[model samples]
Target chain A: MRLELETRGTRTDKGWRDHDGFVGPRQPGTGPRSDPRGDFPTGPEVGAAMPDLRCLTADGPAFDLHAHRAGRPAVFIFFRSAVW
Target chain B: MELQKSMRDFDAANIRVYALSYDEADALRDFRDAHGITYTLLSDPDSDAIRSFGILNTLIDPNDHPWYGIPYPGAVVVSAEGTITRKFFDNNLAVRAGPERLLWAALGEPVVEPLADQPAPLGVQVRVSLDGDHLAFTVQRDLVVRFDVPEGRHVYAAPAPQGSLAVDVTLDENDRLVQRPIVRPASEPHALAGTGESFQVHHGVFELRLPLAVNSFSRSAAPDITISGEVRWQCCDDEVCDPPASRRFELAVPVSGPPAHALRDSRAATLEPNAAAHFRRMSERRKDPG
Candidate 1:
């Protein structure tokens, strides 16, 4: 079976397992294209349109980013880990 | 945790703060209850929102990390028109932009000052606190020691075996105590600008894990023990290095007997994986001491 690994800015099928015992998917690298415009919009740039987001709140309530934003300045924080 | 404390400032500034995470609702709820977090926590178990924001951390190999889906740890300020106004992405993931930094980005200046309760010892803010809400004498505990340096200031990492003074932690010698400071090894090698001397230095806000244990206690009721220690380090900035200094801290830990049926917490937010593993090994070595 063929497996894919994304390491060192490229894709390869080198080692079966990483040092941490992880097996990556068998696929090509998904790096942003050199032609910046071709890259997927990961985040909305300054003055650019914000991406739509719909998710559940901690209380299990549906939350729409656009609805909450409501033409008001909003701050979004992405945390690394709560466990540590 | 810093965000949770200064939530009032965010609210008063007319800014709506939303916490985005890949954790499920249950885990987020547990975290909220445990930490008393009073913000809206948006759950994205599949990291859909994270990817949408282009903040998903793809550096980790998923096979090894069951909880690999995470953001790079950052904050973004968006305007009313659904456009990002300002963003802060830091190299140090452990210490991201706190309320102070975020307020700067949002308001274009420093609106809120540092809390007076946090004193700066040797021009560095040292915050020490126990991991959980309380400590139990039945098992070992962990303490989090955070050091925050001001703008343009830096602190030297622990020196080599034969090197001079650096950041170090030492507990007061006590027969009933088995304490060890589990400091993370610094791998970022920095070179002094002029002298070209290479040394490891920790900039901005960095944290240390301190492991403490209680050997024996005979108190029927809960007892409070003062854990005294000194954090020694040499502060420096781009200009010059200051004299070596030490900041003393006395943490009062309340220890009581275990409950009738105490259940282990398996949640990721409360579990320090590396520390737990190290503690397990230490316990095994103690049991098999030859």
Candidate 2:
């Protein structure tokens, strides 16, 4: 049986494993693609000013990263899903 | 919610934390309440912020339900002036920089634990320890090698002048351990008056950290894993140079299981009974192309 990988998503009998070993249907490279192997881009270079992030807070309020944190040092994380 | 465990410390240091995901606001709200996570959780369901940041995971098809709109999992540490200081992007999505690592970036110093009472040393002292109590799958912890040089003596830094060995750490061949390059403390400039030779050296108390994580494909789910490695260095004083030195280290660290959501008996599962329903809703909602 031919196994599909990467683009178009992979499906299999035992379940597909993502770059990080997250095994599940439609995975092996699901949400938060972990495989650092391929041509994946990690955001913003160091020493550059961090651009503001505009999004909705979990509380449904409109949020701006720079506005929210004020001048405090911050650790910003981009993750997969909370549901999954 | 490992971040929850250190929220007080983060707050005490005046460092704020925020995590973003493709999850909808409602889903994030449910996750926060269930997990008792006090830190901010931002919802980027449209992935606009993710795309703007140039990290949208383009490998998955845009139509992929629930998986679409996710960013390459990583962390960016920003200074109080909004300048990006350091970025932690592990090749594997399962792994993330440990809290201590991030805190170190924000606070400008390693999160040093109290020194264990080790035996007295003959010359330069070396002590190896793990940053955290256990090594959890995908969570990167540090193997910290601390050095103590005698008052007038110092250890060579990287590029130890010709014919000399620089201080370094090398882990034994282990498929279970995913490793990152060594994080060395800044070295001070040293000059030799007699020969007019100059080099970088480290004196007093300093540390070299090696960030490491255990992949999910570890051969066994054994409770404890042995991590063995070697530390090498050369020390010198103005008048005398000590012979090069090396020390082998072995640490039997405990392993933590995968994330809480994957376990039935986890505290998160007990607190969030409706997590499954929330996940189902999330899947169904994504079925509709927007």
Candidate 2 clash pair list: A17-A28, A18-A28, A34-B93
lDDT digits (tens) for residues A27-74 of candidate 1 = 222221111112222356677766777778988998888797677777
Best by DockQ: 2
lDDT of 1 by residue, B107-169 (tens): 675222445686554478777886544454323355667777776777777663244467777
Query: Could you tell me which residue pairs clash in candidate 1?
Result: A4-A26, A42-B54, A82-B269, A83-B268, A83-B269
Candidate of highest lDDT: 2
Per-model TM-score, in order, reads 0.44, 0.76
For model 2, residues B118-237, the per-residue Cα lDDT tens digits are 544558888999997888777889898998777788899997899998999999988677787789988999999999899999987789989888865554668888989899999889
Name the regions of candidate 1 deviating beyond 4 angstroms. A1-42, B110-290
How close to the true structure is residue A20 of candidate 2, measured as C-alpha lDDT? 38
**What lDDT would each prediction earn against the true structure?**
0.59, 0.79
Fnat across every predicted model, in order: 0.57, 0.79
User: Residue B251 CA error for candidate 1 (Å)?
Assistant: 21
lDDT tens digits, residue span A1-84, model 2: 122334333444445545434444445444544244645677778988999888899999899888888999999999887876
Give the lDDT of residue B136 in candidate 1: 47
